[model samples]
Target: MPGPPKSDATHKPPFETEELRQKLAEFLDMEVEVPGSKAKKKVGNFQFGIYAFFDYDKEPIYVGQTNEQIRTRIRRHLTNQRTDAVAMNVLDPFEVYQIEVWPLPELEGKDSKDAAAKKILNALEYQIFVKLREESSFKAVLNEKEPGKPDFEVEIPHSYKGIVVSDEVFAIRNHPDVRIARRASTLSRLAQIISERQVQRGLRNTLLTQATRLRALTERRLRGLEEKAKKQGAEPEE
Candidate 1:
């Protein structure tokens, strides 16, 4: 008997996802100057770091720290969806347009379990948390748990920032109407999760932040659309 005929067309991944993957790879592979070092190092290779995710508007949405390689941790959050935040519906990978990382080059070889290393990491994370909080218009990030308070503040290292989405992807995802819809959907699901279970204050805080974000996006979108309609109405009929 003859075997079944093969399909003529080649199967391919979604264009947006493939483009995003390529751009994210490029961003991660970029090399940056390390403080006090003549040599430059890949940002992804850093074993200890603090990373933040920003939306299309350059608003910081989430922040995290990792003893694992920055590449591994970020890929987990964005590509794999294995992180607690993703699983809990507190974060939507689709919302992340840019990433900024502060690599701790001095902690490169230190053991993850070492107390000194932990202290430095904690201090660095706390510093980043405070910095992003100040920079954020909402005065909050999506992190469910705040970093441990450190007695002393550490000077943040030079940060490498880059957009992870391709132009094609950004053109679709950056539209005000599309963003408002996505934001509202995410906020609804998050609110549902909170209502269905007993949650912590931090989770409730996240819900509030999501609500605020959704409202702001919706208002902005409405304003722009109304302005366009008014301008069209004012024009003389051709």
Candidate 2:
């Protein structure tokens, strides 16, 4: 007799892409202490906050704010191609290895369209944007639009940061050569898009930022290979 019939449900193999999605889901579900409160909330449930994306090198690559749910906005940007940034090729989700989110628990239950709340959100986004820019090696991010300048400022909130990619995935994507090639390809595509259509200055700015990133990664890869060659030449052969 044949063995028990296979289950009706399809057995989905754990591909690296699926592994990444699972890891990202876990990261977003993580609970953290809410600022100025004893309550803990999932980082992704916050309705108003700023979030930043970091590359394999831990370099800040993109920053965004969401008046909607953080989970929804981030998923659209990463898991799908709905976001303008993703559609325009301004940001490649493959490059996002880590995520940092600032959840404004205080803004919970507030109306999404409330003017005061929007101002605070804008201020917070601008603050994080400036801070990230200052900390970045290239002094730039891939945002096509600059954060609005609100008349007032808000204190930056406590942030929850974590890598969303699994170790197995990281090992493959973290190589400098791999990153350089990916960056170069993205740059080429973005340049082509700009060349083919009438575009805004922001798109041009993104192109420039991509170029800078590609150059930096290429230089780093070249240095690593040269160092390896020199070390090998210095070793005595048995």
Candidate 3:
């Protein structure tokens, strides 16, 4: 018998890459950030899977996995609303503005996914946790008790790596009105503490120094943004 004929169409994958990405984004409940906009609309309920939070600087701050809805777990980390973050003080919702998630629908079956799928997710989470820990870019993993070793050998695909959300999502949070509100809150707390003499004499200077540094950073960032916005309105260079 002759060798099989060249199949131009069948040789390619069943689905195109962009189509796959769109499908994956939909499945994972991922949102694309719209530049210079505060308005947001929910995509879909996040499925059970691994998730990670990034800071304003796009550095991994936390790594976690959930057998339940990923959305529920993530909501507890929001700044204004939190479950245990406020009580623990390890993670500040204000600092956690970006999020990337990997939704595993395969794990949702009442019978549970096969052992291999579970193993891959577990090992993937472990690998990501190790990467974040080694980088030490953010404060720390807030809830992970330990970096559990991967129970199974699995390689995280380049395309399937954990998401690092863009910083644009923070535009609304950093708006001038929000900044003033935050300043007022900070002032109120400082006034109460100082009035009650809660700060020790030895620690007062240290507290003041940190406060001043934080204020300076905030001002610098605001000025930088303002200048950039202004430059955007200027004539283009020849």
What would the TM-score be for candidate 3 when compared with the true structure?
0.46
Model 3 segments more than 4 A misplaced: 1-46, 79-82, 110-120, 136-140, 157-238
Error of 3 at 11 (Å): 58
Candidates' C-alpha lDDT:
0.88, 0.88, 0.52
Q: State the local distance difference test value for candidate 1.
A: 0.88
Q: Give the range of the ten consecutive residues with the poorest summed lDDT in model 3.
A: 158-167
**lDDT per residue (tens digit) for residues 24-111 in model 1:** 8999999888778899888898999999999998998899988989999999998878999998788889999999998999988988
Task: Give Cα distance to truth, residue 50, candidate 2, Å.
Answer: 0.5
Weakest ten-residue segment in model 2 by summed lDDT: 5-14
For candidate 2, give the lDDT of residue 41.
86
- In candidate 2, position 49 carries an lDDT of 91
- Candidate 2: the clashing residue pairs are none
